[model samples]
Target: MASCKQVESMIQAWIDGELGDSERVILDQHFQECPLCTITLRKQQRCAALLFEGFADHRLRHSIRQRVMENLPEMEPLRVDLEGVNWRGHDTKPKRAWLGPLMRMAAVFILICLASLLYSAWPKGEKNFDGAVGMITQTEGAAFRETGHGLFCRSVALKDFVKFGAFYKTGPNSHLMVSLRGPTQLRIDENTRFQICDDRKIRVETGRVALDVSRDERKFRVLTPSGTITVYGTVFEVSVDSVQTLVTLQSGALQVESAGAQGELKPGEQTCFTRGQNAITTRTVDTAQVLGWTKAIMPDSEAYDRFAREVQPLKIAELPGEQVFAVITTKNGKPRAVSSFCLAWNPATDGEERCGYDVHVYNEAMHELFSVHVDGSVFANPNRRSHEIDAPGAPIVNAGVLHVKIVPDNSAGKQTPLKVSAVGL
Candidate 1:
């Protein structure tokens, strides 16, 4: 059965008889069972009737007969033939000779009248509605090219209209955002330059852009020096530099075509196109990490430390120190019920580098929701000396507090010091 909200939303379409049969059935059943909905439907019908009644007084002021006759083809004069006619075996001259002329006049008048009525019923000129294809909705530290005037010092203004061939450039710390009628949302990354080729295409001169495109009949294309990324309703990011263009899919799917080679990308997958390479290279990626900057979140040591202190240990012989790197929460301060997590782990010594740790996550009721095993290499890294672990399946609940416990494997003795930090994605 359709919910009350769904039925209410389609009430206008229902009254217009524009809904599909299945949808109409759902709304009908809901209205029958719900008296409030029934009353609302009746009121809507009454209001529609009253509104249409106002148009009944409208009248056409022009003469229909003249307009109709002017649009019709020229008619020849009518002629009557009596060559073979005979009456009672004798040639007969018609007594009603004037009847032919009168009939012709009547036929002309009736034809013109009929043509006038039909013309009057036909629709008038339809007005074309010109809507924008895209607009710059937000910007920070970004600038736009003025074609012969050079670059402007400021970013594009809110709701600034975007036209074909327009160029946008962003600084190292800049972000340029755009929205299109396709409901396609875009965030241009820092040090990037791109052109609006048209509504269906964009050209990336350099840098990157994260896109959240809704399903559209026409595919959206991002062109780079190396290749083109074709999207049909997907959340993805594309980056291009002098060497290569990287396409990452956070959700949905897309196709990458370059130099007579092609490949498809799925969620959590990414592919790269090199300038001179014939075959495209594809690999797995942590989508949250790759697209986090588009969401305005970056790797912050302060945030990492804050989340690290919230780590708790479970029943293990020893616990390496654990840290919370990030908390993936919304503006409302509620942790996403299902999201990714970035965990950083540091081992105390190389001897215990290969150890495994069991991670437990619980809801507010202290009920275990799920657990993940952290491989030892997660605590090993050459640069940071700490491995960044991408844990994607964390089940958070409405109550919002995550009770996480980390326990080391039996290979480790008591009093093991493991440094770990985690961030929600």
Candidate 2:
């Protein structure tokens, strides 16, 4: 069954007769079972009826028929033959018989001409929406150029595509961050210039960026003026200027390739590669001062207090084989409410065995409510999808753990382990 929130979005389409037959059947079935949705549907229908009535009361003060007809393409004259025997059993010619047919032909011709114009006005730049591998989750005073070769630029906005081969830059004190499909989070600091080459490759021209990249089989690469930095999954910052390129690692490990040599940086380490120099500079550094600006990217703790669980990153199925989270529930006086916002995971390697599992939800009585079956093949990261607990007029009846279980599918025992993070709303 669809969530109440999702069904509400479809209600307007249902009223407009835009829904397909299959969807109509599903909506009808839901209305029969969900009284709350049924009431909402009735309210929406009333609003639509009122709006339609209001439209009926109004008319255009002026007519465009003359202007349109003047520019319309010429049509062949209507040919009507009133040669059949008269219905009145007399040979009286029908009065102005061609006039009715001519009028109908004119109406149809006008509609056809107008439809052609309407279609012509639609944007032809729809191809720009293709090849998107990431989305801008946050932006401030940033500008984006859809194509690297174009001088045209537009102000960046949240949820805008981080399209492949596109250029993005930020002004002083401005910030931009993209949630790549690889589930990597890249925060571009102000005065930065960069372009995304692909899902895992970016070329930096100048300024700095902080990356909290998720682990994957493929390595993420950042190309700078001095060299290229490569790593599987790491938290780090990279800055480039006219003189040299600087890199700092907060967690995990990264390798900088420059001057025909490879250098590695451990946690709390910083390295600088000077332009045209074979020597690489290295030093221990403070992570807070260099990347403290990224702290703004974290969700506010106080604001998320209502959430029963924050984002919990789990490294599942390495050595332990399996893990389960459970807590006994004791019924309280109130009903239970359940809602989750985003759930993401690094998918199994392409064409590799995928781990499968069941995420089960329960009520205060420990009754199974719903289950989300997860696998790497169809289920992977940057998940903005939401799931809501179906409890009619309900709140949490018990003060126990909100999530109930995660049972591994034993049948697919050879499946690869998956890294997952889930958050409650």
Candidate 3:
């Protein structure tokens, strides 16, 4: 016979016939001698029948629990007489009967949240991708209202919803945003399986997911097949597969725990571990490519196009902020070549050695690519008529780069912003 403590969790499974024969036999015998158990079972059956007869679903139960969890924390814990309530031959009547209206309000609230997500996800001339108040990142296709026992979709839903989110899977072409509470936002690549283990922990079983976790006192965790990342508010990524596990930290601080060993990760650091192995080695990473998916748009590759590769005069002045410099540069300047807006400008200092200037190149996303510091002493003529700086270590020249941020020689302490009008691609 099962004890009271043992039967608490099994009651629902037994009611749903999810228990095996041995388990059922044990529970049945115990209930015969236990009035509390028997009474509780009867009430459960009545509630289940009433619920099924009216408006009840697995999702609804989950929704209710989540709502309760979120709001329950704000409420004072209530004390009730458990033994008297479930005793035999007692009419279990509640003291207050305001439950009906509370249920109605909760249902209304759930509906409003669903409607909000639908409106936000549906394209309305422009994406309502505004400030992320909360997150519900999901995959491409969806079938609403589960018809059968299966729910086939992967999405970002129910952030800070007070309960664990079940395992979610994404199929091919499943590049979708990863929204979490922290009100953190991230995106997962395709063919990924992950689960929210708890309020403070998530596990990525396979494939890649990146998150920008908000800084907080709580210790959130991202677990992978290789190791676990204990975060203290950071942007990072984890990937899992048969052979290896990879973790990349973009910013913030985190600790990676591997096989019997752990190490803290610094920003721009990457670490990978082989399956069932302990060795951990870290290397520097170029996050512009690894974390590019998080960007508003892809990195600029137009600089390589034939026409875009040619060099011509940009002949412009000043800088364009916020606007896509790529679009503006393509329209006004020749591709693949970087030229000053004007033919030349004489410096206040009569051309010091090393030009005392070098230019830093960036893609449209403002990721610094390379810096070029020219020795003004290179040109014999003393005056720089057409200041066409060649891209050091890069064959592309300045054709289709986003823009120049800074060009400083060894004297970065006295560095000034590059005054190039436009860089053509």
Candidate 4:
């Protein structure tokens, strides 16, 4: 004499296939004897079959089919009133209808989590080859020279003509960002060795160098056979020889920490470090003089004026204050002209001198025709005449100002002016 409530509970568990063999046998006996409960069970079974059939055929359009099926067994038939059934010896409330939505939400959350995990596990691309070797630009004969044992050398083919430094190691040049403030030239003497350690540390085994450091925080490391030099947004020079090392400060400030002792080098100051010694000797020198090795004539009012005076007889001294110089030549008795100027400067402040330059040109109206900021060419010799302004184009025309400034190996922040003028045929 199973109660109606007992039959209903069994019906739900049977539909879900959760009944064990003993419980299933008890429910089967009840269904055979109870005509009313039997009728209700048959109807619910038909509904269950229809639902599953649709799911198996892929005809159910809902995205939450699993969740809907989980709750199907709990649903009552149209003729039956679950409230009248005595559920068990004690009564318990039915499960909430929203359980289906909650289960579906949990499934969605799990899928999203799995997708994120896969994305995070994906492999990244390899690092750039040039970056790994600390080579920033491949200008002139500035190319990477491979050395044995995971090391590389940055060497320039045109030595006397192009005095530029190369990264000598397997890692990216830690000082590559120094170029942004302006071009920096590092001169690595023949048979000298340098190493780029990772992307931040540098080691110089044997060599002499002149560095024009830029005003960037990351551009702050210099190493020598004797010691290491660290800088923060400053211009300076460093050199290393067999017996001693030299460090000169051109502008800004630098702090040298080595051998358990620290020293500060200021503008116009130089420090000498002897091999196997922890002591550093400091002395004062003309900032400009110490940086002269890297200085070269740069395009400016003074250089321009010197060029004009040499090319033409125009007395620039008598020219109106507002008037500027322009280069002119006589072609078949007609005045034909190319208004331009060239100037050079030093790229290094150390013992090694490297030259860089700028070019400027103006029209007849005293308006700037063109201008260009250039460093030593990759194809030109360091000693041979180098032109910073390559064949004139749009950059010059848009410069707008008639006066141009130039600095030669100028770590001192002083710019030389060059004046230009047209020559009369």
List, residue by residue over 83-178, the lDDT tens digit for candidate 3. 332344345457436787899999999999999767655432222232222233333432121112334332333221212455656667645554
lDDT of 1 by residue, 259-303 (tens): 756666879998988765666668999999998887772323432
In model 1, which runs have C-alpha deviations exceeding 4 angstroms? 1-131, 149-155, 297-425
RMSD of each candidate? 32.4, 34.9, 27.0, 24.4
Candidates 1 and 3 compared: the better one by TM-score is 1
Scored by CA lDDT, what does every candidate get? 0.63, 0.64, 0.55, 0.48
lDDT of 2 at 137: 64
Cα displacement (angstroms), candidate 2, residue 101, comes to 34
Candidate 1, run of 10 with poorest lDDT: 309-318
lDDT against true structure, model 1: 0.63
Q: Residue 363 lDDT in model 3? A: 59
Q: Estimate each model's TM-score.
A: 0.39, 0.42, 0.36, 0.32
Candidate 4 lDDT for residue 200:
33
Q: lDDT per residue, candidate 2, 1-425, as tens digits? A: 55577678889988998766666776787789899999999999999898888997585668889999999899965332222211333454577677888999999999999998666443232222445666666666645543436554566755555666888888887887776754677888888889888777899999988988766545578999888887767899998998888899999877776754556688999998865556455799998899988877642233222111211121122222443322323223222333341333444334444455666665434466666766533442333232332333434343333334555565443444333222322
lDDT at position 299, candidate 3: 17
Best by lDDT: 2
Q: For residue 22, what is the lDDT in candidate 3?
A: 62
Worst 10 residues of 4 by lDDT: 173-182
Q: What is the C-alpha lDDT profile of model 4 across 1-425, one tens digit per residue? A: 45867778679777787766656666788789888988989899999988888789676466887888888777653443333432343344345567878999999999999997665444222232222222232222223333335352333221111112334421222121111112233434334456545333456766544565433223356777667687534667676778777888888666664564456676889998864555556899887876674444122344234323332232122211111221223333234432344443233233233333344444423454554654433213335432334435423332222333232332222232333333221
